[model samples]
Target: MMLSAQNLTLARGGVPVIAGLDFTLAAGQALILRGPNGAGKTTLLRTIAGLQAPVSGTISGADDAIAYAGHADGIKAMLSVRENLQFWAQVFGGGAIDAALDAYALHPLADRLAGTLSAGQKRRLGLSRLLVTGCPVWVLDEPTVSLDVDAVAMFAAAVRAHLASGGAALIATHIDLSIDAEVLDIKPFRAKPVHFSGASDEAFL
Candidate 1:
C-alpha cells in the first residue's frame, strides 16, 4: 500500500496551511513528520487518513489501507481497557486482543475502566487499538505523547517491526522518536487559519 500526496493543499475554514506538498512512501519506508506545535502536522495527518478532505490536491492510495492514531487517546472512559480492545477488534473484523494488550503492557489494566487510568496508561491502551486495524499505512499523530521512556522505546520498536514487515507509517511528533524514517517538515505547507473538526478520529472510521 503506497501513499502519495501530490500538490496537496490543506486548509481549514478556507485558509491554506500547506500547499504544493508532495510525498510518496513505498512499503518498508517510514516518513516522520516533524514540526512545532500548531504547525498543521495533525491536519496533514487527518487529510492523509481521509478524515479531512484537502482544500486542493489529492491523497490517493489503497482503499481501507490506512490506520490512524491521533494525539487524543480514543478510548471510552466508561469501558474497561479490555472492552475497548474488544470493540476495536470487532470494528476491524478480528484481531489478537491478548497479543496487543501484552505488547503495550496493558494487561494489568485490562479489567480497569479507562476513566480510572492515568495519562500514560490511557495512551498505551490507545496504541493497542492499532493492532486491531487491518491496514498497511499507519498515520500516527503524536504517537509518543504521555508515554514514558519504556513505552516510547516499545512504540519505536513496534514501528520498526512494522516497517521491517513491509508496512509504512506517516508519524507526527514534536520530539524525536529515533526511528529510521524520512523526516518531513510541514512548515513549508502550513495552512493558515486551520480550524479542524469532526476529528473524534473514530467517527471518521
Candidate 2:
C-alpha cells in the first residue's frame, strides 16, 4: 500500500473531530475525500501528510513518501515560475524542471514572477510543484480552488500521468475531475463528544 490508516482519529484545536477511520491507497490508485463544510477531511489529510499528529491511530507508508499541497500556493513571491520549480526540485533531491513546466503549460510563464501571475496561473504553479517532488504519494486539499475549466483539466491530466507512473493520490475536492477514483465520505466518521461524569471532566470537554 502507498498509504494506509487504521482506526485513525483526528483532532482539531485539541478536540476530536473524526474517529474510527480506516482507508488505504495503493500505487496507481486515487482516493477522493468527500464531505461538507466543517468536516475533518483537511485534518485527516494533514495528519496523513505528517503535518500534524493524529489524535490516535497508525499511518503506514508516509515517511519521506508524501507530497502535500494545501490551500496556500506555497511559492516564493520574488521568484519566477521556473525558479520556484527549480527550488522545489532541488529540495526533493534533484530533477529537471522541463517536464513539470510542460506538464502544466508553464513554459510560457517561466520568466514571469510568481507574484505577478493571475490567481489561476499561481495555482498552476503551486500545483506544478507536485511533479517535481519525486514522492509517490500526493496529499491535496481543494487543489482546484483557483483553477478554470482548462486549468482544471491540466491538473487532472497531471494526476492521471502521475498515477500511470505508479503514484497514488489522496485528495479532497468538490468538483469532479473525471478521474477513476474512489470516493470516501467522512461524515460517517464524525467523532462523538466525550461524556463528562465529574465537574472537572466537564471542563475538559
Candidate 2 ranges with C-alpha deviation above 4 Å: 195-205
RMSD of each: 7.5, 1.8
Cα lDDT of model 1 overall? 0.85
Error of 2 at 199 (Å): 3.8
Q: Check candidate 1 and list the clashing pairs.
A: 16-191, 16-192, 17-189, 17-190, 17-191, 18-189, 18-190, 18-191
Tens-digit lDDT track of model 1 for 1-205: 3999889888766567677899999999999898777777888888888888887887788468988999788999999999999999899898679878878888888899999999999999898888777678899988898999999987888888789988999998766778888899877766555445777655758
Positional deviation of residue 166's Cα in model 2 after best superposition, in angstroms:
0.5
Clashes of 1: 8
